[model samples]
Target chain A: MADVEGAVLTARSRVEVDGWQEAIRASCQPLLEAEAIEERYVERCIEMVEDEGPYVVVAPGIALAHARPEDGVKRLCLSVVTLAAPVEFGHSENDPVDLVFAFGSPDSTQHVSLLRNLARALQADLADKLRTANTVEEVESLIQGIVQDVKED
Target chain B: MTTKGNPEKRLKVMTVCGVGMGSSLILRTTAEKALKQLGLEVDLEHVDVSSARSIDADVIIGQAMHTEEFEDAAPVVVTISDFTDVEALKGKLKEALEAQGWLT
Candidate 1:
């Protein structure tokens, strides 16, 4: 199983930009600015979204954006932004992604583990609560619940 | 007397991820099913992405982020979102193999 640290789920709670790239960048920029990840890594994450159209939606309402370590990843952080309204990705059952989780890992091996663990955790009802969260604290609480569950398990 | 009969060699594939479990294994199973439908016999293995460079296979499949590791080893690489979307992945595998002329 992948080692999952409790995500710092930021209460972005909405798409603040027009296009998908802009929205992802908006969601990711704060993490970069806080030194959670390097700036170049954000660009690569955006590129992955543009290239693949959000194939990382492991479950309903949750989408994980990531790329290779060489794309300039510096740290491991799970930054999140929930849209007030989900956005369209122009794919079947892929649109309306309410929760955007951006993962930045320096190693591909680590990333796969992370993806697996994350997918497992999100498969629960807590992920659904996260989708409908109205406040940042509510989102944080949901994330905390998952973190606790992960630890206990 | 010259021997002229030569059987076609089976294609080999490796689907790798962080661990040889979970989604990676799911992907491996999906790839195997797809290749079988394509009438290709494959030798498939599941390993960590770090060991991907050492694995000997004709194609390596994984998330797009890990593409660089297998860039030199696997002549055909298919990077998709996840292996859950069997139809989409089938299309991607077909495209990759056909591009490499590995498809009959």
Candidate 2:
């Protein structure tokens, strides 16, 4: 597994958004500021949800927002944004998402290791912890714990 | 080469999403774990839903939104609600495999 020490960026606090579109935009703001991805990437992600459906709501209370690397990814990065209140993404099984993860990958390979590690972490209590976390450090530590666990394994 | 009724014939499984880079990759990892537990070998790849229609594969795994677009593209289309739930994925995959006569 790749070391995820600096790969993750967390919002300073749980953000208040009007709906899923704003939720996705807020989630990708950190990546946009870091120059890891362009504005088009964020727009494309929203467009995808509009065109298709809420398939990004991969789990209950969680939304993983991403677009094609060709859309505008400058590097490989991930961001976490927790909502002050849950927003519905129209997903029947995993609606009312409070945690959103935005991913930016320049290519196909590097993100796989991070995602694989994330997949393991998500299966645990990480989502619940993230949703209820009060501080950015708390969210950071929660993600760091996942990275540390992967290293140990 | 293996003869008839052999389980060694590797199956091609594709995991798909709208953009293919994010959730599909995660689903691929989960599917790999599920297939390993079932003692099945598979050639798994992740693709966008748009490209998935033309890609040849024995089974296609994706969210309900995307899978409905390719119902006729593959012999088996498995709709997964939660990508992180490996047990659910395993059960769905096992049922699909058994229905296709790939598992007994």
Candidate 3:
């Protein structure tokens, strides 16, 4: 594990953004700071939304911003950005996302287990809590809680 | 390419994604939530696009970009805008099941 919480805490909380473009950039900042990904990675995530029509809106109020590892991923990482006011991702069902989870992995298989745990935690229905988080510490606590839950499972 | 029209057969649902770890698992969780909400049951799995080549599923679901790769692996390939919207997923699965005579 590459310290999911540490990887995430690299980005300070940004409460406001101009739009999804800003949102994706804000979300990937920590990963970029950590050198887990490069600028092109964020651009690729944006390109994916524009080209594929916002399939990243994995759940209501939650979007996982990601692209091919070839886009610019240097390591396995998870980063996040939360908004006080949600922005539309053009998704018919799960539109207007407030929480965006940015993931970068070396390949399809490298971070499967780590991401698998995160996926289960998301499936545990933490979107509302994560979306409402006001600070990075709160987010880390939430993530730490999930990490604990992941360990227990 | 086995499209068993039998209403009694347990539907085998598979979710696919570009790499499959994060997105596909999320989709599977979303699919299970929807199916459970509608009182539907099935055997569901999640796999990456590359691994999806040989998996036999009654209906393979995924985001639009990577689903086309699985067209030959399943009788039906269901594409969706978002993988986590339970309502949309429920609606699509119902439509597919209805078309198969699995639902009235």
DockQ of each: 0.07, 0.72, 0.34
Model 1: lDDT equals: 0.62
Using lDDT as the measure, name the better of candidate 1 and candidate 2: 2
B1-104 per-residue lDDT for model 1 (tens digits): 11113245666788776534434554665676677777777788777676777777777887665665677777788876645455666888888877766664
**What DockQ would you assign to candidate 1?**
0.07
Checking candidate 1 for backbone clashes, the offending pairs are A14-A82, A68-B65
Evaluation by lDDT, superior candidate among 1 and 3: 3
Q: Which runs in model 3 stand beyond 4 Å of their true positions?
A: A1-14, B1-12, B17-21, B32-56, B63-104
Root-mean-square deviation per candidate: 8.5, 2.5, 4.6
Candidate 3 C-alpha lDDT tens digits along A1-153:
444433333334546887888888888987888888989999989997787667677766788888887889888777766776789888777778888888887786565555666666776666767766778887767766755654565
TM-score order of candidates, best first? Answer: 2, 3, 1
TM-score of chain B for predicted candidate 1? 0.84
Reference-based lDDT, each prediction: 0.62, 0.83, 0.74
The stretch of ten residues in a row with the least summed lDDT in candidate 2 chain A is A1-10
Mind giving the per-residue lDDT tens digits that candidate 2 earns over A7-77? 65455458899999999999999889888899899999899889878889988788999887788988878
TM-score, one value per model: 0.57, 0.89, 0.73
DockQ of 2: 0.72
Ranking by lDDT: 2, 3, 1
Candidate 1 scores an fnat of 0.00
